[model samples]
Target: MNMAISSTPTSFSKSLKPSLPKARVFNLLKTPPNSHLRYTLNLKPPPPRLLFRIGNPKSKSQFKSHHSPIRSLFTGIVEEIGKVKQLGSDDDGGFTMTIHAKTVLEDVNLGDSISINGTCLTVTHFDTQLFEFTVGLSPETLRKTSLIELQMGSLVNLERALKPSTRMGGHFVQGHVDGTGEIVSTEPEGDSLWVKVKTTPELLKYIVPKGFIAVDGTSLTVVKVFDEEECFNFMLVAYTQQNVVIPLKKVGQKVNLEVDILGKYVERLLNNGVVNAIK
Candidate 1:
């Protein structure tokens, strides 16, 4: 593919300008129709060309989010919408929360873990008739998550724990919220909705454009991440607009955020190697 002259050939004689001694000369031969011109230089042959590989071309799959395989995890797929029936302080200085849901409670148990807006909690009690379940939120959960913003009659995204037979629709979510982000803005594009969230750099360090980020337990692809501004955004299609409670949230409100767990695992692995090498 590397040719001295371009494919668009110039006048063969005009292009060739070789200063030669009187004894030896490169005679410009007559041109052939529809054929590439070749120069038979009666000089020394050229040396062998050297080659070296630099790097691979940029991938077209940059927009694709990676999936992490986890055995018992929340897929970040909201199974149903639930209402906060109770939000009160417990004797342990923690919060006792209750939600009224049906789908997640169909096969629930006392010790079963359920994700409420991406915060994993163990079911302490359930009532088949009432179609509700109770969970206790520890002080650490309140400090790390947006669960403290819950109030009575508030709508929440609910999802049951993953099972072997369950379909993995979204990326692996531990239902452990990394932090809370304030809704900076929301825009409507036709039927879809674009939501922008601003968080601290502590959490933004793990977020990346085209990667996965769970907002309020709904798995969504990050459209863009503004590192300097400490904000990230994702779009919700028409279907998602109706399925989750995110669409109803207005600007300035906080939403629970769970960054992709894969990033954390990679960071730990690489940092450990550096420490070992130093030793």
Candidate 2:
């Protein structure tokens, strides 16, 4: 599995400023646990610049970042707000779901990739009248994500596959849920909310402070990590809290978690070189 990092200076500095070192790529392939990956990304020049104003007065519902990949990539940026219309066990002992969506349904087709709480699902059927789509969930998907907890009228985050022309904002999210986690607690820090989530040791092995984690399909940065507790903390800005459904979840509620794809790739590369790792 070859990983490539590319940036163009011609674009806005906020989109692709500074630059990443070639060595950082190599380090990711060999770094040990507890060692952080270091790279200089100057989306702009020497004197760093803030991409957006601290208080733009825009609706919190407005997603500030629009630059994401175009080719079936999800930056963990929730592009639309969808609601659960139906959820039940299929005849095959699987799960079938109907979700009503607005934005993502505009140009959707029969087999489009739609990220539902960070777990990618293929559209099986759709109703143009209600702007709804149906998806089938394998037993494995239920085991790995919190989608099983969904009920009718449950609001979920939704994002369409990346378009190649968009600018990458969040990070590469394959919509492959690595595991599920539970919210341990939430504390208010000024206007922001800090959430603590607890998971398993096997899953914690891949999380790192400052690393990216998708909580219920929204991309967030891990602020603090507790190895002994098998938990991590992330801050939710006012805008995020207002826009996503995560804040509405109770302390013990389960949430889907997708760790950074880059980390998983690096781990596989180190253990099996490349060919065998993917297998």
Candidate 3:
């Protein structure tokens, strides 16, 4: 989905100057730049507000689900770290990506659904000896995801679709990216690790404390969520820090995000007034 960002016009900007609350105006005028008294006045405003959305904030979910719902489940347990061998735009304005992978290729077949950085894609071709597979991405997927920015040799988390016999290690992931988020900061907190990520306001609404979120195809529990800041916190255990690709990411690196699916379903039911109809 394309976002139309509107800049504040000269007239609107001028109007805002006088509409500041009296307390804010006094604080701004009297406080010194470096003084604690100016802290509140200098507090950063929240990130840009996005247009409200009723469906999954990530545009990938806006596409129709092609496979059966049962075949859509992913455990978010990355089977392997795949490296991009080739990535280029196709004549159709989409993209074609070939990944060098091993474990994920063990039983993979053409038409199999694979989760690459939390985005589900169908395998179009593969070479068993070379341990490589190709997937085509649509133009819409490129716009809403960070995958388009991937370069050759970039590493990505890979997972195959869940089977009934597979152990349920992580939360259910549909491989439908809700959006992309950037790592704002990372620091060690005593024995654990704390990482904060900035995201859009539309995506922030569905996030909750102790909620499930898929980051770079790994399911993690949210430690805290700052609605006003448009950011969320995640506490990482030693195992997570050692295994997931996110820990290797720097502050500015973008990560694919998939909000809890339950929130999307609830929003749909509420928006359609299904409860009222049932009554």
* Candidate that would win on lDDT: 3
Between prediction 1 and prediction 2, the one with superior TM-score is: 1
Error of 2 at 8 (Å): 51
lDDT of 2 by residue, 45-149 (tens): 422221222223331221111122323568788887888876654323234677898888888897788888887787777877778888766544544456645
> Cα RMSD (Å) between model 2 and the true structure?
20.8
Q: Write the per-residue lDDT of candidate 3 for residues 83-200, one digit (tens) a residue.
A: 8887653323234678899998999877888998888888877899988988866544544665644666778899999999999999999988888887888999776789999888
What lDDT is obtained when candidate 3 is compared to the true structure?
0.70
Q: Write down the TM-score of every candidate.
A: 0.72, 0.70, 0.73
Model 1: per-residue Cα lDDT over 1-279, one tens digit each: 111212211221111122222111122112223222233233232212100100113312211111212324888889999998866543222346678999999999877888888877877778989998888655445445656456667799999989989899999998877778878889999999999988888899999999999999999999999988899999999988898999987676668888998899888978889657767
| Clash pairs for candidate 3 | 58-178
Clashing residue pairs in all predictions, respectively, total 0, 11, 1
The list of candidate 2 runs beyond 4 A from truth reads 1-71, 91-93, 273-279
Superposition TM-score, candidate 3 onto the true structure? 0.73
Q: Answer with 1 or 3, whichever has the higher TM-score.
A: 3
Give the CA lDDT, 0 to 100, for residue 47 in model 1. 17
TM-score, cand. 2 vs. native: 0.70
